[model samples]
Target chain A: MATNRQIVLDNRPDGEATTSNFKLVTSETPALADGQVLVRHHYLSLDPYMRGRMNESKSYAASQALGEVMIGGTVGEVVESRSPKFKPGDQVVGMGGWQEYSVVDADAPGMLRKVDTTHVPLSYYLGAVGMPGVTAWYGLVKIINPKPGSTVVVSAASGAVGSTYAALAKARGCRVVGIAGGPEKCRYAVEELHFDACIDYRVHGDVKSMSKALKEACPDGIDGYFENVGGYILDAVLLRTNAFARIAVCGMIAGYDGAPLPLQNPTLILINRLTIEGFIVSEHVEVWPEALKELGTLVAQGKLKPRESVAQGLQAAPEAFLGLLKGKNFGKQLVKLI
Target chain B: MATNRQIVLDNRPDGEATTSNFKLVTSETPALADGQVLVRHHYLSLDPYMRGRMNESKSYAASQALGEVMIGGTVGEVVESRSPKFKPGDQVVGMGGWQEYSVVDADAPGMLRKVDTTHVPLSYYLGAVGMPGVTAWYGLVKIINPKPGSTVVVSAASGAVGSTYAALAKARGCRVVGIAGGPEKCRYAVEELHFDACIDYRVHGDVKSMSKALKEACPDGIDGYFENVGGYILDAVLLRTNAFARIAVCGMIAGYDGAPLPLQNPTLILINRLTIEGFIVSEHVEVWPEALKELGTLVAQGKLKPRESVAQGLQAAPEAFLGLLKGKNFGKQLVKLI
Candidate 1:
């Protein structure tokens, strides 16, 4: 018998999640069935969207039931294989949950992807070269559809998705303005991401001033808006949006918790002919290969940089997720389980 | 010398506009300029957008200067033509302002469209066949983009734009539900406009309950929302929108006053993948002729009906406009200046 550690959802959270929400215990694993692979988990991705799954309410994705092992994307080494295609010591990325070892059918949809760590770190598979990076890329290029000389505004510009969008938009010849919560992230957005301007919403009194600052920075009013933090930021952007503007509605971290927040002003939509659209990254999986190839080259060419704040143990996953929600993480927060 | 009675802005109101904000003044007509036609205002159109123009602050259109004649759209007779294109006794429509007579240039855009009282009343130009009418048509067909059998919802269903959109969507094989303030309007929306169902938001007490009622009426969830009165109604609709839903944002009658209101909840936008677009009819002048032709044919076939509340005289324009802002006037509010 093989023994491995697993993290299960002990209880659903009331408001903000705490360490008590998760329970870590040892579990016995049986022999793998035909075409099955027993993998040793090495890294786990800690993300904001996972917080939504922890709740028992409705979300874009399915709910993580109470008492089940917490679901997560992981990169691991295959210790045992029952299929001809895989042998021992094969490295792959899969949804292995929060477990030291998992038995998965090799033929399962999205079972695994063979990763080459020579060019990038293994954790890169859980961040920049994976879900978050492509989310920013596909959202900006395909949804917002910015043209050269277009004024682009992005929120949470130091985070994984927003940083990717800012760098890509800059390379595409667009003038990018970013909005973040603190001065440190604001400085990082401007200095490292090469954004034309950055506004610290925490310091700014209101969105109207932010709009004036954005207008001053870009000269041309916002033509494309990559929304990450919704609420006042969205309302202010609505006022400054030019005619025929496109808004890629990405994330609304401001309203994710179960509080009843106020809504955005609606009249701006009529004054400026604006189109706001929302989408999920997984919905565009078929086109991932092309997006990944382009993003990889950009990374290799030093045009795009992947920033990560790696927490060096599975026990730190809760803190990592908490830090991510509070915007305390420097960049893409990840947990290393190896 | 011809004498004209006009409504002038007495003073800008602080919040809800009062009768004291306007004054009826008798003035002598000025001589017409070259290539200009002197129009005797026959049918003055009173619209909700005029309330926005009354403010001293800048809007999509210029604000009404102090003591200036209130701006409005009207159908009139070309009693005195200084140009060869128009002649005396010719009935035309133009921006005649809120007066009995005005000198208009022959070449002004939306300058005039001749009306025949035989098929549809000249007031139809103020209601179903004019700006408000086209607003509904374009919002439903062009912006909302509803598919056959899709669920559609409209706010202020007794109002010109809302009623027209509901009627048109019903004609296109959609399951239409309308939100109105009173039972009378709700009854009319279902019994007359042929909508599948209607919700009286005022009677519901809370938007959540109304949203539940709306969802029950629309078992499949909302695919299209024609937003006329934004605020709680919009927030409720945001909660119930199906994936890939489209919102045609026309006006937020609830926010017409200068008071601060609650912002829209944006997280619903991301979870449902909603597309909310704000548009004005003037932006699509090139396509107006096509839309008008199709809408006129529908009216001629009795598949569409135009509704109007005709005020008796030019001096009554101020009261009519006030009535429109208060939702007192049913259907399209118009002043028959003839």
Candidate 2:
């Protein structure tokens, strides 16, 4: 019998999360039933949303129960298959959790997906051409719904979701502006990601300074905004928004640690007539085909050149994820489990 | 020529608005030019929105210009008309500001409207059938857009906008809840306005207690929220929102004094996947016909019964307005100019 290494939730965090909250255990792979497939994970995705799941409090997503394998997205090759949909050696992507191997019910809808790694690498499924890509599509296409020449801004500009969003917004003929933590990431966003401009939040720490930077970056004022990191960035964006701006609230990593993140000026929301909507990508599966198709096309056309920050092994996942929560990662944060 | 006594904005407010900020001025009403009509106002409407116009800061509406008449809604009689649409003895509504008489260009579309005071009282036009009623309709129908059984909550329960909103929600088969300043206002909302439940913010005092009261009042949780007053009321509502709730931000009287009002726990916005939209009713003129039609029907059917607090004369407008802002006025505050 093949043995599987898995990371399980050891305890819930009181304030800040640490690697001690997770426990790595080894167990024999369970025999697959009819219509099931065994997948040996090659890569595991680490996302900010995972931090929310690790909490015991009620949120949009279900909490990660103690003793259960940590929930995550994984891309791997099918080792064995009892279903007609998947054959042995098929490259697939699924929610395989934080594990070296996963047994999935292939017959269940959306349980597993076969992906072509002809031109795009399999790891992209966990990033640019997969969930994060779809996430960018939903917020930009469905929520923001900007017109051509409309000025749009995104926070955490060098991250996977922001990178995809920048590519998509640029394709729409929008004036894309980005806000990142450091000068290096900001420079990469403008030069590599082709963002029209990028503002370094670290250089301008307070709301007043950041607002001045935003105003200078977006002279026409932001018509649409994708909020990934809230607090000062959001407050700064609100100060520079034109009439009837739309904001898609994707993530607030600052508040992920359970600190009370107060919005400085909700009054600006009324004054500017803004529509701020919060959404989850998994909740909108109907946009998957269309979103993935465009994201795939962009990747194929080289319009979207995604960078990755890969941790060497499964044991490094907790640290990598913790670093990601602190904006230490340069791009998509993932752990190589192969 | 006619001598018109008016209240003009003497100066902008430094903090809380006071009578000293407004000056009682006398102006001559010039003779009606072609397509112009002379309106002798009977009642001048004092609304929370006017408080916003008092500030020099840019908001949804334009600032009330200094050394000019205090801009307000007025219901009056057309004294003379050169335009075919209006004539002598006709009751009408227009933005006549804080004055006894106004020379309006009647030919301008939506500048002046003739109303039938047969079944509906002329003063009701200043409250339920006019801008405030339409404001309520736009927030509830367009922004909130709740289903039949949806539980909707509105603040400023006994005010003109909140009263109308309750009736509209009830007619649509919704469970309508409200939050007002005092126990008297709360009782009036539940008994007179027929709200399912009404919480008194003064009694509850803070977010935690108000949230507990909201849990009991809105047992199913709020599906939609209409925010008229910001601060602790909004914070309390956020804690009791059901998944996918919609919020229509109408006003934030608490912030009109240029104080920085913050939204506590914006993380709840992401957790609840809520849609918080801010709108100005005057911006959506297309919805007016439909909204006004529904509002008029409800008023006629006795489903909507509006209350008003009228001061003796035009000179009392400044004091009456200050009272309205301080929540001392119980209903739609107006100045009887006749």
Candidate 3:
């Protein structure tokens, strides 16, 4: 039996997540069942939503249990297979979690899918051409649905989801404005992602100042918004939204630490006749095929280029994830487990 | 010359509006132009939305300018006509404001509409078969779109909009809940309006208590909410909402006085995947013909009954409006201008 390395959730965070909350363990891989396949993960996708799972609070997905493998998206290769469906050397994508190897039932519905990495890179499957990409597609197409020539603003502008959202909105003839934490990420969002403008939220001292900057960035008031990092930015956006504006609330990274993020002036929601909705992308399975096809094509054509902040080993995932929550990572935070 | 008793906006209120903010002025009714008519107002609609117009801040509609008749919905008789579209003794509904008479353009689109008072009472055109009735129809049918057998809650349950909304949702086979200011209104909501349950919001000391009451009232959790009072009640409802709940933001009467009504735990909006939308019914003109027809039919069949708290004369408009804002009126607040 081969040895497998796994990182488990050791404890729930008191406030901000730290490395102490995770535990690395070595164990022997169990013998394959009748319909099992062994997958050796090459890349593990680390996202802000993982922070939500670390806590015991009610979330879209189940919480990461103590002494269990931390849940994550992974692109890996099937090294051994007992089932005829998945053969050795076949690259696959699934919820392989934070581990060196995964024993998955090949017959399990929606547990794994084989990916063609001929044109698109295997790592892109964990980020741009995968869940994040599909998330952007669903929120933009289904929720926001910005009209041509309308303004759409996105938070966490240089991240996997935000970058893809900006690109998708821009392609639809929307004037895309991005809100980023620093100057570098803002530059990348505007220059590389082709966003019309980007605001460095860190430079603005308060919500009012940030609102002013956002107002300047979006000459026409925001008609749609893709919210990732909520709190002050959301309040500012509420103030700047035009009548009949729509907002797709994807994530509220600011409130993941269990801090109260009260919204001031909810009356604006009535005055502006705004429609705000929160959604989990996985819940909308019907759109996956359509969204993935467009995202895959965009990545293959280099039209949706996504950057990654790589961590060399599985041991670095905890730190990388913590850094991601703090906005330290430049783009998609990934653990190069191979 | 016919003397018109007009209630003008004297000064913008700094806090809560008072009768002093309005001035009863006597002016000669303007002569009918080639395409205009002189209307003798019989009843003026006093609504919660009127409170929003009393402030200088930006609202869905423009602020009522100082020294101008406070804008409102009114049903009256066309005493004089210059255009063939309208004639003497014809019953009509228009933006007749807080006055005994109005000079309106008969040919102006959306300025006036002739209504049948034979089947539905003339006052029904001001409450049940009119704007408030259409408001309930639009918010329920268009925005909330509650599924049959789902739970729906409406604030200001005994008021014009809420009473109509509760009745409408109940007629659609929904389990209807209502939040009213007092036990009297709560009784009216349940016994008269046919709500499944009603919460006396005044009896609940705080949001936590109110939320507990709401949870008890809505054992299945709230699927749809018609938000009329948007302060603590909105916060409470947010706590009690089920997944994918829809809220129609018709009015935020609590914040109309310029007090900050911050929403605590807006994160629930994300966690529950709620779709909250604020709408002004007038903006959706396309639905009027369909809505009015249905509303008129309901009123004619005695299926939708609305009560009125009628103030004696046009001079009583200011105090009635002020009382309406304070929850002093039992039902649809109206001024009998005749």
Candidate 3: residue B166 lDDT (0-100)? 78
Off by over 4 Å in 1: A28-30, A77-91, A115-121, A205-219, B87-90, B114-118
Candidate 1, A73-99: lDDT as tens digits = 888888999987678888888888887
Computed on alpha carbons, the lDDT of every model, listed in order, comes to: 0.81, 0.92, 0.90
- All candidates: DockQ: 0.53, 0.85, 0.84
- Cα shift from native, residue A99, model 2 (Å): 0.4
Cand. 1 TM to true fold: 0.92
**Residues B1-338, model 3: lDDT tens digits:** 48998989999898988889999999999777798899998999998888888878898778889999989999999999999999999999999999899999888899898988889888878787888999999999998898999999998889998888877897799999988888888888888888899899889858999999988888999999999988889999999899999999999988888887999888888889999999999899999899989888877778788789999998888888888888889888898977
**How displaced is residue B294 in candidate 2, in Å?**
0.4
Error of 2 at B108 (Å): 1.3
True contacts kept of each: 0.67, 0.83, 0.87
Candidate 1 lDDT tens digits, B103-211? 8888775676666666766667677777888899888988887889999999878888877787688778899898877888788878887778889887875778877
Q: After superposition, which runs of candidate 3 have C-alpha atoms over 4 Å from their true positions?
A: none
Candidate closest to the true structure, highest lDDT: 2
Candidate 2 residue A221 Cα shift, in angstroms, is 0.7
